[model samples]
Target chain A: MSGPDPERFDAFDARLKKAREQRQEAPERGAVDRSGMGTGLQAGIDVVAGVIGGLLIGWALDRWLGTSPVLLVVFLFLGAAAGTRNAFRTLQRLMEEGDRR
Target chain B: MASPLDQFIIKPIIPIEIAGADLSFTNSALWMAISVAAIYTLVMLGTRQAALVPGRLQSVVELSYEFVASMIRDNAGREGMKYFPIIFSLFMFILFGNMLGMIPGSFTFTSHIIVTFFMAACVFVTVTVIGFMKHGLHFLTLFTPPGAPKAIWPLLVPVEILSYCVRPISLSVRLFCNMLAGLTMMKVFATFAVALGIFGFAPLLIIIALTGLKILVAFLQAYIFTVLTCVYLHDSLHLH
Candidate 1:
């Protein structure tokens, strides 16, 4: 075949350049970009889930052993403490990831 | 119209009873099998031709491979690459399960807490085992936050242990709630679409938008699940 047309090649080069520029500008389009809102939500979930999990386990234990509210109260506080710690740890990790970027 | 929640009913596909334990293959099990098969086809057949320039199928396979690979690298480092198969499989299974559930009549396995919890428990157990295996009793140090006051060890240790224990619950709940909410929202909107008759177009538009969001959520949840697994793996491998 004859050599490729310069006009077609120029158009292709421009298109490729534009695509590259777009890709660079919007590199955070995928899962890599963890927004503040997403991080906050995840942290919130971690905390809440921790507390709920602890409460359930504590209540179940109390029911089995007939300890009334003692275990429930104790575990509830422990769960909250755990939840808070989890939230803090999650936030710390997210911050470190952000700093690395 | 059927209740939106009705879609999640786990009716047995092949009812089987052994010693009074229901070991029947249910809809959830069926869909799980389907998801596995779908992923196998996509990954195995899709990348069969290791071409210089990938076709559509090969591109998808490569993209998924790189996505999980980079995720593992970023969060867990090169050492974590050893568990790539497990993480990759988890991602694809959840991704496909969520996507497949969006089909009108299909069951959403991920939406069920039982299913999600089972998967999450597996990850938690595996991670914990790996940590113990690699570090033995030193893994207990994972609970001790560095630089914390020695006096507060009593308070900090329990909290750390509780949080560690809660990982499976949180992991499972996150995926379950997201899938459940998306499916519920779609069902409620579809109901409105039917009730509105000609004016159903408004709800239809919302449903379409919701479906797009659900798709995004599906992919994001899978990524989040995998990334969190990597994070836990990192913690296990390199305790602070």
Candidate 2:
């Protein structure tokens, strides 16, 4: 609701962002957003999360529509894309922050 | 027996037809409005009472805030904080859309290729502009992998261009297809669970498992979309 805070990210580069979310206080979201190997790990997390989310609705729809897998397939890809995209942004943000300083 | 897919259709409440184009606003529009309102209210309500100890609602709100904020911090950095409005808004939008679709008789716009594609396109185009603006034509260098032999430039360049152009298409289709397919399978399996009488419990159980997974997917998908935007932004700005 409120505008975002205008602070830059932490001092760590891709490495620290992956090693631990200490951020100095980098939470899971922050961890995922930061670059490094963490992005890959987070990307996997993203896909699984999406598939889980999609399956629920797909089940409900199948019950309603009598069509299976259509929604499941569609939403799964959606989740994967969503996950990959998130990782991409996190990597860039970290790089940019490093460059800024 | 109404087909579930029928419900996904975008029928116009207020038809807008122009020059052989049908860009009508439908119940989907109504639901989209509702989703936005619901997300805004819940988030604001959650954050409005930011607590030291944290209330139940506030905790959940904080989790989301921290989750997304951490994501930006992790990926975008302190500077990425500047785009919080866009990132946060985008996350909430996807989250609400996904969650709302989980409800019965709801339209899953994200399941539609057009909708997801457009959303992805926005990220792709915006990131490109940011890249060009920030780094000038040097961003073009992103097409060339650093270690590639110079002789292969003619081949690799086209492939790179193709991949870059396909970003939004891949991004959007992935979301749309995943959502649509997942939703469709769940619906179909549910029918089996019911039609098989007591034996339907197996499918039902599977569906239940899928449900839990889907919730994770909802948040993950939103996170993924936003983070990708950040990554692309990073690439654009740091092309070298």
Candidate 3:
């Protein structure tokens, strides 16, 4: 393989280096890089955390409603709905952004 | 009424009980087949008419291909491009499964631990095996930070090991629980919206909002899964 174009390489490197110098707050860059392991891991953490948190809320609601399995069952379904909804929105966003290009 | 979570209960068309386990053709499995058919039809029709300027069909197909390609490129780099087939298939499957599950009485496979666990475990095992295949037992060194003090090795190593072990569990539970909760909530609220018998829109509006949110969750969850796969591949290749 010949390797990436030198000009493109220089442009890419320059943007990254410049972004780093600016402390990563540009439109093309950000403080948080959602590029690798961290993004996915963080998402996993968030989802797990959200579910547990939601369960607590749901369980409490169940108690308030004077229903045993009701809240647990209802909120579990709600949580799944929320998760799937988020995933669909993300897909549309990605595709839309891709279309913009 | 029919149990708040009755919708999520995947009844099988062909109830096949071999010995003990409930191995039946569940609603989830049915929807999965439908999703696959949809994909097949879309791909076939989209690719059938190849044009230079590109029609709507061609554009849809091409854009999807490029979208996934760019995602893999950005996250997994050029080397990981080879896994595009697996990654794209996964993205589509999860995406379809999620969206279809949102259609009122449909079953969300991702809401099941067995399904999500299987998917996450595939990523975990694939990456681990890939890491070893690429870097040998040296991949174990991934647990140790690059510039950490030797004193912290014992502490960090065990923590890292535990975190790694929990990977599949976390991934599986997160998807499963989220779907389970969302579907059940929708059902309960819908029941209330109807049973209110007097003032209805209150629960109706809430469930509508929740359903909308569920659609967002579906895409986000799939993206999360795919990104994590890319990250794992990245770690396997880069070892950091």
Best by TM-score: 1
Better of 1 and 3 by TM-score: 1
Write candidate 3's Cα lDDT for B38-61 as tens digits: 777878899997878988988988
TM-score for chain A in each prediction? 0.67, 0.48, 0.47
TM-scores for every predicted model: 0.89, 0.68, 0.70
Q: What is the C-alpha RMSD of each candidate to the true structure, in Å?
A: 4.6, 13.5, 12.2
Can you give the lDDT of residue B69 in candidate 2?
82
Q: Can you tell me the CAPRI class of model 1?
A: medium
DockQ of 1: 0.64
Off by over 4 Å in 2: A1-101, B14-23, B49-53
- Weakest lDDT window of 10 consecutive positions for candidate 2 chain B: B158-167
The true-versus-predicted C-alpha distance at residue A80 of model 3, in Å, is: 25
Give lDDT per model, in order: 0.90, 0.70, 0.73
DockQ of 2: 0.04
What tens digits encode model 2's per-residue C-alpha lDDT throughout B22-65?
Answer: 87888888788989999878888888866799888888877778
lDDT of 2 at A59: 66
TM-score of 3: 0.70
Off by over 4 Å in 1: A1-37
Better structure of 2 and 3 per DockQ: 3
